[model samples]
Target: MQETERLAEVRERIARAARVARRDLADVTLIAVSKTHAAETIVPLIEAGQRVFGENRVQEAEAKWPALAERYEDLQLHLVGQLQSNKAEAAVRLFDAIHSVDRPSLVDALARAIDREGRSPTLFVQVNIGDEPQKGGCAVAALPGLLDQARGAGLTIAGLMCVPPAGVEAAPYFALLAKLARDQGVPLLSMGMSDDFETAVTLGATHVRVGSALFGARA
Candidate 1:
């Protein structure tokens, strides 16, 4: 499908899913995950009214952000992948929100980077709800301490972000994330993706990152 048609179709899917979940369409924000696609593909989607986009790599984001920003000043870029502490500087410079901050060193680096840039973007602490050590997130048990530290450091802690375990059911993990968000007293819950966004929305997800569902295969 052409980009315009694809954009409309994705919006319709969001609306339909919201209806199925009995949630207001306005309450669910769609983030186009434009990670590996070229600028040519992204620009059409932007022109089609997709203001929010997601990128996985700090380096890739750093390279594309300048051009995207120049062409689409209203674009809101989100860093959706595991962010390394060393890449924090470039990540802060390019993204409007960082969704994978799961370590103290990463948080500290982000604080310093934001301080240097004089811009503090919204941050979401990635929680390894399934307790996957290989993942780059705090284990669920450690979230409170991390949340306290991030807040004490004056990082704009908007809410929690999580990626449910691939093989396991997503509902329980998502519910746990919602509980964590409530306990932390944060409002935003960035969860859900193409396959399970309806469940995420039903569980109070404020933002759903949909890529393949919208843009088809990642080229």
Candidate 2:
């Protein structure tokens, strides 16, 4: 019941934010990030009207989603974390969308996987917005070529995804990512998390991956 209320509250907040920004609420897709939490906990949110979910790991999602997706009618799962070249086949086979398509190697892997399996998931090229050494996205400058590569390989290049630097105001990063997408003529911007999603929507984020605010703090 508590999860249901939280889901409603989050939806209301997203709707209000979209209204304030003069954007249709239907245009924004809220991805309930279900990383670390079990399927039992996610069922309530699904019952409460959340059809989209994001997971950080292929193994963890594979362990849980096969059964959950079998039971649920319209569930959409997205891989929203770093994806390894080795797991491209599994990720492509299991997920409806992949938000961490970052590097040339992973791109090659996914292309082959898609060809072999006869399936192509919606692909988002993650850009390392902060340019931090440890993060997983391609450099901002490399986006065009990477996008070209994915498209050339016949993959469905959905849009761009990013995670801004921690402990800093994220609006600029989000805005910059949105600009990059527009400059390149890409249609979707997968930005924002639980904290600044409303702000991201105001700046034209089509998809927001929210975790904590929806599922509560992870242990």
Candidate 3:
């Protein structure tokens, strides 16, 4: 299917999911994960009225978004990948929301960066919901402390984000992340991807990051 067709299908899916969950469609924001695709590949989606997009890296986003933003109106970019402490400032300046803040050092770096740049991107504390040792999220037990650190450093905590263990049911992880968000008194939940976004929306995810479902598989 073409990009526009894929986008319509995904939006319909999201709307259906939202209706089934009795949630307003407007409450859910679809973030087109345009990480690997080039500007030419992305323009069609933009023209199709996709205003929100997510990129995985600060450098890649820097290379493309400046020109794209100049031509587009009301475009919102999010950083949906693990962020490095050294790139905090660049990420802040580039992304409207960041989905991978999981450490105190990162919090400090982001705080310093925000102060210097005078721009604050909405932040989400990523939790290692499955407790996978190799994942970049912070441990579940450390959530409260990390949240406190982020807040104390003057970073606005928007909500929580997580990518569940691959090849397993994602509902439970989405539910857990929702609970964590509620317990922390945060409002947004940035869970779900192309494969499990419907489940995530049903479980209270306000943001869903979808890539291949819209862009087709990456080469």
Candidate 4:
């Protein structure tokens, strides 16, 4: 399928999902994950009114930012992949929202970078809802305290983020994230992806990150 067609299909799917969940499509922002894809592939989506784009690597985002941001001044860049502390400065300068903040050290690094760069991006604390040690997220048990610390460090705590275990139903994990967000009094729930985002929406995800479903399989 063509990229424009794929983008439309993905937008339609998100609208349908929102309708099924009884939400206005506008409430559910579709973040097109642009990791590994080049500027050529993403520009078409931008032309089609896809304002929000996600990138995983700081270096890749840096390479793409100068060119893209120059053309689309209102573009909202999101760091949806796991971020390293060393790349915090680049991240703060480029990304408008960060999805993977698993470690407190990285959070502090982000705070310093944001201060140095004079940027304020919404921050999400990544929680390993499935408790997979291999994954880069804080355990569910540690969320409240970590959130408190993040708030104290002058970061605007937007909400919680998580990627559930593959092959298992994602709704429970989504529910857990939503409840945790509510418990913390945070409003946004950044769960869901291309495959199981509808489930995530039903469970109260305010924002859904979808790439493959939108742009077709990434090369």
Candidate 5:
């Protein structure tokens, strides 16, 4: 399928999922993950009216977004990968939202960066929902503390983000993330990906990051 065709399909799927959940379609934001893809591939989607995108690396986004941002109005770039503390300032300046804040040290870095740059991107604290050792999110038990630190540092905590274990059902993890968001007085939830975004939307995901479904398999 063509990129525009795929964009239409994903939007339709999101609308259907929202309708089934009795949620307004406007509540869910679709973020097309553009990491690993070239600008030539991304521009077509932009021209097709896709405004929100997610990238995995600061350097990669820096290389492409500056020029793209100049041409496109209201383009929202998001950092959806694990962020290194050293890159906090660059991430703050470039992304409109960040989905991988998980530790106190990183929070401190972001706070300082925001102060210096005078720009605050929407922030989500990623949780190790499945307790995967190799993952980059904060442990479940450490959530409260991490949140406190983020809030204390004057960061606007948008909500929580999580990546469920691959090749398994993602509903439970999405549900748990929702519950955690509620418990912590957060109003947004960023969860879901190419394979399970519909499920994520049904379970109260306010944002879904979809890549392969829209861009085709990455090389």
Candidate 6:
């Protein structure tokens, strides 16, 4: 399908899913995960009226988005991958929100970066909901301490984020993340992706990151 048609279809799916959950459509933010796609590729989605986009790396986003943003100034870029402390400043400069804050050290780095750059992007603490060591999020047991450190450092966390184990049912993980977010007093739940976003929305996902479904297969 054409990108425009796909955009409309995805929006409709989101609306339908939200309605079934009795949640307002406006409460859910559809983030087109544009990682690895070039500016020429993303421009069509922008023209299709997609404003919020996700990038997995700070360097790749730096290479592509500035040129695109010159033409599409209203775009909101989100950093949705594991962030390195050394790149904190660059990530702070490039993204409107960062979703992979999983440790106290990162909290310190981001706090300093935000202070130095004078820009406070929305922050989401990623929880390793499955306790997967290869993953970049904190363990569920360690979340409270991490959230406290981030807050004490003056980072107003937007909510919690989680990437469920691949090839497994994601609803349970999404529900766990939502309950933890409520327990922590944060409002946003950045769960869900291209495959299970509808389920995530039904479970209280305020933001869904969709890629191949909207942008086609990545190069």
Top candidate when judged by lDDT against the true structure: 5
lDDT of 5 at 30: 99
lDDT of 4 by residue, 55-104 (tens): 88889999987789988879999899899999999888888999898888
**Taking the tens digit of each residue's C-alpha lDDT, what string does model 3 give over 1-219?**
899999999999999999999999999999999988999999999999999999999999999999999999999999999999999989988999999999999999999999999998989999999999999999999999999998888888998999999999999999999988888899999999999999998999899999999999885
The digit string of per-residue lDDT tens for model 5 on 1-219 reads: 989999999999999999999999999999999999999999889999999999999999999999999989999999999999999999999999999999988999999999999999999999999999999999989999999989999999998999999999999999999999999999989999999999999999999999999999985
The CA-based lDDT of model 5 is what?
Answer: 0.96
What is candidate 6's lDDT per residue for 1-219, written digit by digit as tens?
A: 887788898999999999999999999999999998888888888998899999999999999999888887799999999899999999999999999999888899999999999999999999999998888899999999998888898989998999999999999999999999999999999999989999999999999999989988989
Query: Would you list the rank order by lDDT, best first?
Result: 5, 3, 6, 2, 4, 1
For each candidate in turn, the TM-score is 0.93, 0.97, 0.99, 0.96, 0.99, 0.98
RMSD of every prediction: 1.5, 1.0, 0.6, 1.1, 0.6, 0.7
Q: Candidate 3 clashing pairs?
A: none
* Per-residue alpha-carbon lDDT of candidate 2 for residues 50-73, written as tens digits (9 for 90 to 100): 899999999999999999988999
Cα error, candidate 3, residue 201 (Å): 0.8
Which ranges in model 6 have alpha carbons more than 4 Å from their true place?
A: none
lDDT of 1 by residue, 1-219 (tens): 886787788788777878888888888888899888888888888887889999999888777778779877688989999998988888888889989989899889988999899988889999998887777789888898998888777787897899888877799989999999998898998999988877888888888888887778988
**Model 2 stretches with alpha carbons more than 4 Å out:** none
Query: Where does candidate 3 have its weakest 10-residue lDDT segment?
Result: 147-156
Candidate 6 global TM-score: 0.98
Q: After superposition, how far is residue 164 of candidate 6 from its true place, in Å?
A: 0.4
lDDT winner between 1 and 4, please give it. Answer: 4
The per-prediction tally of clashing pairs is 0, 0, 0, 0, 0, 0
